[model samples]
Target: MTADRQAVTQVLSGLAEIRPWYQDLYRHLHANPELSMAEYATAERIATELRNTPGADDAEITTGIGNTGVTAVLRNGDEPCVLIRADMDALPVREATGLGYASTATGTSPDGSSVPVMHACGHDSHVTCQLAAYRLLAAHRDTWSGTLIALFQPAEEAFDGAQTMADDNLADRIPKPDVALAQHVLPGAAGTVMISPGPIMAACDDMFITVHGKGGHGSAPHETVDPVVLTAAIVMRLQTIVSREVDPNDVAVITVGRMEAGTKNNIIPDTAEIELTVRTYDERVRTRTLDAIHRVVRAEALASGAPEPEIRFLSRLPLTTNDPAVTEQVRQAFTAHFGEDRTRPKEREAGSEDFGIIPDLFGTPYCYWCFGAHDPAGWYAAEAAGTAGSDFPDCHSPYFAPLLDALDTGVEAMVVAALAWLGTDRA
Candidate 1:
């Protein structure tokens, strides 16, 4: 390592040290989880933590930027500004993990429905680590140059907080960042960081398809067109889009998550609605997949002699692609700290992230990584038994629980990434 590299890593390692105090903060946030855009208490707590941290004076902060979002700004020297982000919303899943910190809290969802809340997605860890990273970077401002813009984004689960920040002029408020960085905790062995050069996460589209038909008694099959049968045909045909239409090499998924048609066995409803989530890494595949779905739904409805079906696209998330050179630099820096074994390369996942909004909107290059949130031995063992991730709790599950041991690696990785982007030259 060069003298400057050594000096920066040592100083940053010391600064990013996980303190005993963060445990309670993490647990408190986990226990009192809030839903997207409704993170009133969660937002307040994060803002309070940064405001009262030891080096609070160096950072100028704001709240309510994107409706319960908080951004803290810290400037060190003349180097290029670096943006670091963490999501701040919890999912509507009730806690089944049985941890002491598992959320019993229920909150209002975006649609104004009362739902149980839990940090099943591990946003709690993301927020806690960002708080730690920001405090340390601010405390040791003399170690590196450039500005630090840390955003505690709300509504990631609702799929729009990062975009909301952009709409509210997040990039214009602070000078646009030269490099953007964010990390997520996924179900894997602890202490490892998964990095991919381009298309780390899939592009996601949420849509709903409605099948129209005449309502009639179940006993009188000839009198009415059965919407339930039409719904079944549509669902089955959707399965062919990936296996038959899209190239085998291209990654894509079409999931029919929700289906509703009849309230009673004897009654054939007038309409059946199906909610779908589509994932793809390539735009062409995404387009072809969505188009195929529309065609299948429409053709099936028409063949059934039913009225025209309705299709509505709910949300679209851009694909997340890491900047090649920047990713390699961060990978090398992580390998130095985690060794070659822990800092391994990863492939593009079918999962999606609205977090990609940061780089897309700011026009800044970004690198996203997944840090494992489960014990290695158990995770591997679980995978062996035909279970999820070697038994690691999957995100968004009522039973999801992130291993706390990964927190330190996440904090340090963010610190190392920021230091690298901010450069090693000291003032």
Candidate 2:
């Protein structure tokens, strides 16, 4: 075996000895989840773990960056730096997994709803894997020469944490990272990692449309302008934009997730509203899709003889693009550490990630890969049942669970990638 592979094997073996502790940490975070912008306890727990870590030095805890965000710095060398990020916030989903460590923690949302919070999106697992990788890198600092910035960010689900940190000049304050790396726990193909070269994730924009009309008695036929009809027409026409306007091969998705109009059956409402999410893989498509949406809404409303619709863009997330050269480097590192069988080319994902903002601002190379979360039983059952829709609960679902046993593999993969980038050893 090559020297680099030998070193990776040694690190993996060492990681095995401490896997139990990492699992415990994952369980702890899973059981006590926190919501976005309210991750005070979560941040404190992660900071404590980093402080207790063997190679952790000069750990700094800063709060209120993106509203309840925390960033911890770990340095081993004074050379060029790279940043590894892990999101720390959890969803306000009620636990339904019935696991022993299921979350019973409760929090009040900004909307004043009492909800049970859990790590249903697997942010807990992300944080745990990040800690494990940090420990391994620290233990083997002698093998590489560079700086490591381990960021524990908050509010990824809301998709504003990365941008908030960047706006505060987080990168310039620390060693400016030449490249940024992050990973998401996916619910597919256990024991495998998936990555793509560019535009791996889609840009997401939330749109709200309010349609105003004349409120009158239901008995009136021609006297009232019915916004419900106008809203319905708009939703139906919105789909045509994707099917007819956009190229079928381009992968643009426009979904109207919510619609509300009237509260009383006997009376026509004065206003109707619809909320939609627009997703696209390219900037040109993103702009065209949005502009088309507005045009369709206005034209439909005018045709229906109703008032103009009020359109608002609630929020947006940029597309995640992986630099081709950096992605090839990562693939080479994975091949050197693991066998050729363990590494495979990946396809584009329709989902969005806040990490995309880094590449938008600094023009730094960024890549976010998927870590498999299926167990043996889960994998077989899914395959046998032909229900492998999603191997684990989706990121925002209430039942999202991660396989802790596979974490060591993820840590080792990250270590190999980091070492390869530092040009310390080659197999």
Candidate 3:
């Protein structure tokens, strides 16, 4: 075996011993989730865990970054520095997995409404794996030499955590890393890794639109402009943008996730609201798509003799493009450690991430990868039966549940990837 592979194996030798602790941690986190930017208790728990770790006594721990983010830096020598990130926020999804440890927690959402919160996106697994990886690296310090920065970020579900960290002077607060690394638990065969060189995830843009109209009784629709009809027309026209305006070769998705209008059946509402999300891979395509939306909304309103609709941006996320050199190093390490069968190339995903913001802030290169947490048997069965889409529950779903076997895989993936930059010295 190569020196790097040997080093990785040595560092992970104690994984079996530490597995139980992290698995329990996963359950605890899974049952009690915190919403975006409100992860106060979660942040404290992470700091406490790092402090109590065997060899992490000297690690510098920082808390309350970006409201509720945490970072622990463990240094073995004056070698390369690698920053590994994991988000700690949960979504406003109620638990439906029916697991004994399923979340029954509730938190106030950004909209000031009480909503059930759950780790529907597998972030609980992300945190557990990261903590386990950090503990292993610390316990087996002789196997590698470098500064390892374990960052637990907050508010990722709101798509602003990375930016929030940067705005709070994350670079000045911690040692700048030569490269950044992050991983996500996805729906695939357990113990497998998914990686790509560039643009693994798309850019996201959300907009809230309000269409104005004159309100009147429902029975007298002829006397006033009907915003419901105008909005319907706008929605239909928006569909044509992808089919007619954008090139069929490029990828772009426009989803109208929310619409609000009249409250009573007998009264026509004065205005209608629409909230949509736009996903795109290319900057030009994003711009073109957004411009088309503005034009279409205005044109449809004008055609209906209604007032121009007001459009406001809800959130924006840049495309996640992995550095080729960084990705190759991690990919080779994964192949060497996990073997060819488990280390596989991943296709471009339409989902969006804000991780790019942090590396961009540090002006350094980075790579983010995914690992399978779904049951291998079930995933393969779905694939074989051509029912993968219908059979497998994806991230952000209340029913989304990652198998426990993936916890070890996630730790191994992070350690292997971090060691690619940290060191290859024998223990």
> Best candidate per lDDT, number?
3
lDDT score at residue 93, model 2, on the 0-100 scale = 87
Residues 1-427, candidate 1: write the lDDT tens digits: 6533664566556543446667778899999998888889999998888888776576778899888889888877646888899999998898998898888999886577899999999999999888888777777666677788898899988888988887887766776888889999888778888887988889999998888899998999789999999999999999999999999898898999999999999988899999999999888898999889989999999899999999998889999889998898888878877889888777778877888787778788999988888887877677578685535567898887777778887888888777778856663
Error of 2 at 46 (Å): 1.5
Off by over 4 Å in 3: 110-114, 213-230, 261-270, 299-308, 425-427
For candidate 2, list the clashing residue pairs, or say none. none
Cα lDDT of model 2 by residue, 317-418, tens digit: 988888888888788778766667656567777878898676556667867787667675776588689877655576677776666666766776677766
Alpha-carbon lDDT of model 1: 0.84
Higher-ranked by lDDT: 1 or 2: 1
Model 2, residue 145: distance off in Å is: 1.6
| Candidate 3 TM-score, C-alpha based | 0.90
| TM-score for each model | 0.88, 0.90, 0.90
The per-prediction tally of clashing pairs is 3, 0, 0
Error of 1 at 159 (Å): 2.0
Cα deviation of 138, candidate 3, in Å:
1.5
Using TM-score as the measure, name the better of candidate 1 and candidate 2.
2
